[model samples]
Target chain A: MFEKYFVFSPYFWLVLFFFIPLAIIFKISISVSEWGMPPYQDIFLFDNGFKINTTFENYVYIFSDYYYIGSFVNSLILALISTFFCLLIGFPLAFYIATSNIRLRNILLVLVVIPFWSSFLLRVYAWKIILQNNGILNVILLNLGITSEPLQLLYNQYAVIMGIVYTYLPLMILPLYGYLNKFDLNLIEASKDLGLNRFKTFFKVILPLSVPGIVAGSLLVFIPVVGEFIIPEMLGGSDRLYYGKILWEEFFVNRNWPGASALAFSGIIILVLPIVIFQILYSRWSQKNEI
Target chain B: MKSSLIKSTVIFLGLFFLYFPILVLIFYSFNENKRVMVWKGFSLRWYNELFNNEQIIEAFIISIKIAALSATFATILGVMIGYSLVRIRKIPFKSFYIFLSSTPLVLPELILGLSMLLFFISLNNVIGFPSSRGQLTIFISHVTFCIAFVAIIIQARLTDFNKNIEEAAMDLGYNYTKVLYKITLPIILPSIIAGWLLAFTISLDDLVVASFTTGPGANTLPIVVFSKVRLGLSPEVNALSAILMFALIIIGLFYFYFNKKFKH
Candidate 1:
């Protein structure tokens, strides 16, 4: 009954609006490319029209070139560094928020999440202003007699890391909050009662229990940060480039459709591999814990 | 005791880091001079100019229209998908379908934007509808991704939902549609509203997707601010940011107030 309605009713309008465009795009992509098949496919539809042999040319090009490889490294370094910083800052904050007075918890959560409602672009742009040579930070520093001249805070790697951590810190905090909320206070008390110090108890008990949330939050931040364009683009400036910026340049600047597609597919694969593996490990661990 | 003091200090520093830029933007919006960094006497000249600025005003209106329309469409679709997934049984590949649908939530905005742009161009070439890409395409793109997020949130709420009441209503001879309208809809209305608000904010906050999908003469507020910032910091931009920030804070406060008041 539902299938018949799905076929005949106006619901198809939604499906068509959402799905058909993608299908048609895929169709055209196959037709327009000289390969006459997707680049990943091994066989051509027609023998004479175009060649279709699967090759690692795209990956080779991306990895072999200094610019592309440099961007990839830059992306990895930035994502890892920012993820580390977010974890370092977010763990304690999450713990505090989770264990704080019940009355204050909701208000604090709201405070952390309220900034998300503002335009992400605006937030990043605000950071650009704050970090610029003649920006507020520099003005404050000059007035305080800390520096002889304005500091170069903007258009650098540090600014990019700061921008990323600022945007993604909430992603880390929310999950850690979720994990820490379910934490049994009795376990910590028992550990303290057994003569383990607070720090050791936290490191051994609380941290182990919260591993799932940490993994979830880290993946959430790291995956998106790998493909992030705007923060790095605005803060990193022209001199610095990342994989995301490279992909953007390929599509918009070069208008090289095949190259862009290749880069996108590869980038997605590279970034998602670790996440998929992590999820698999997490699920296995969860299953073990459940049993 | 010393450790607790350190923890408090760390939390305070984090809060300061999160809010410092916003405070600066708010303060500078009232600065008398055009120089954004320098301490100038307080004035509302920039705020007045922001209100008077034609481009900023038009962009703001356009953004609102897009956000409202897209959020409404996304919410309706999201609620449907959420309800269907929860209510249906023996559905094939449910997990895979859910994962595929929710992938947009994790995918980078740049890739999504680029892929959608490519998809729209090919769509125009093939079907010839939406003969020109502009506001319509942008709204569609926003709705596509926003629906995924809305669905995820609503689905979480629906999974915890009790269905025996609905079953009893159905056993009493109400049709499925009637049962949904009379029973399920009322119960899930809060989640629906929450989903709508989420979609609204996502659409409003979008810049990358909108930048790629929006065409000539259809620049949104973020695009305008981004371009202006690329040139240099302006008090007008700060004024605009301050206004946007104020609006969001008001909406958030209103949401919290209503949520608490209506809970009982």
Candidate 2:
């Protein structure tokens, strides 16, 4: 009886709060937009006669607009470049940490990920101070005579990418370390003994084995970075707009409820839904392998 | 010897990249200069200002209250979900259960915030409840996202340990509730604490979701901090970041200690 209660209570809460909210997004996404207090007409209405009204105008509106489409493309490019840099930097660190003596490995791994514990907004804010015109980096440059004056550093897309990589680096490293830690160091020795050069040995052995880690880390960084708003808003200039910024603008800046809902729903459909299905299938496969 | 030298250099560089900004933030928090960029003799001017700033203090209080409450609630429900997933096999719509519990981990915060906001509006319209969005809405939102985090940690811990302990307790004639309360939960208590810490930090750190669901008087610390720093950096915020980052990093170390997952 108690066990059943344990399951049912949480089950009910998730369905009501989590599942229903997602359904509501889908519902409002399909609703008609109008000029009003709520800015979207109700789907269910009964006045002189019972009636149900909905429209796909929001979806069409977003698809047709170059501004919305372009912002999403920009986010994708940003995510791609950031994920690449994260992998470039993170892979080596994760590899070295995973290869360390077990005791040292544990300590190093903790050090790598502990920064994630700090506030995300503060981590990004820290970059703002560092990238300031007369900030430490510029001060060092001036002292070293690298540049005659401070370069504009803070409010640009490059700064956005730098902040993303700096913050999301740990996310990439942790998962890669998880998979890398499981492999035996002897594999490298075995590949070398087979007369393969270091490059060939790595490509033939270590790289193949760590594909799952690479994929996991890439998805972990890529998916969130695509939707990330804070980094771009805090660190970026108006030179570029991202999906997250556009979505925020639609809702809070412009107060377009249905349009915002549509954008969010489309994001789920385009970016999230397929991943959810893929993850479900992947878990099942992993479970079968475990069994 | 050469390869080892390369490895050490890579590790040191990576750590420097990771820690450089944090050290800068901490260093500047004590700078006496009113201009945040300029370094002067170290003074505690900003720390004094941070404590006296009523906006930040009130926001900090609200954030702590929300994070603690939501973390506790999320842990309870999350422990249940984790337990159900690992031990109980007869869950109806098990796939749906997995989907609901895990999707929040990956879903963008912006999308999640919008969905929750729309749901609350829809609820208020049809049911005439939650007439205003404030702490209650934010708390619910936090718990909803946080459950997945706690659940994942608990699930990992439960899966790693032997189930024979529970079986032995049952053989000794303890009821299901008694075994869970006395045996299973005790063994997983560290993980539960770890999960709660993770959830607490996540709730306290949230800005996007809270911004969407927040109403008058519900300004969380992150929201308040973001508004202050979004336009430009503030010295008061620098002081707050140093203090908060230190506190949070300590909690993280405690989490690693309790979970013991950091060990080889």
| lDDT (C-alpha, whole model) for all candidates | 0.76, 0.93
| Chain B TM, every candidate | 0.92, 0.98
Chain A only: TM-score of every candidate?
0.81, 0.96
Residue A35 lDDT, candidate 2, scale 0-100: 83
Cα lDDT of model 2 by residue, A1-291, tens digit:
877987898899999988999999888888898888788887889986889999999999999999999999999999999999999999999999999998999899889999999989999999999999988889899999999999899899999999999999999998999999999999999989989999998889999999999999999999999999999999999999999999999998898888898999888888878888998898778878987
TM-score against truth, every candidate: 0.89, 0.98
Residue B170's lDDT within candidate 1 is 93
lDDT string for model 1 (A1-291, tens) is 452331222234344544454443333333333433222232355667887644455556666889988988889888999999999999988888887777887788778767766667778878977887888788889999999899999888899999999988888988999899888878988999999998899899999999988988898899889899888878886667898989889767766555666677666567764565554466457546966
* DockQ values of all predictions: 0.44, 0.86
Worst 10 residues of 1 chain A by lDDT: A3-12
Off by over 4 Å in 1: A1-57, A143-145, A273-291, B1-4, B254-264
Residues B125-182, candidate 1, lDDT per residue (tens digit)?
5588667678898998898889788777767777767879899999999987788789
Give me the overall lDDT of model 2: 0.93
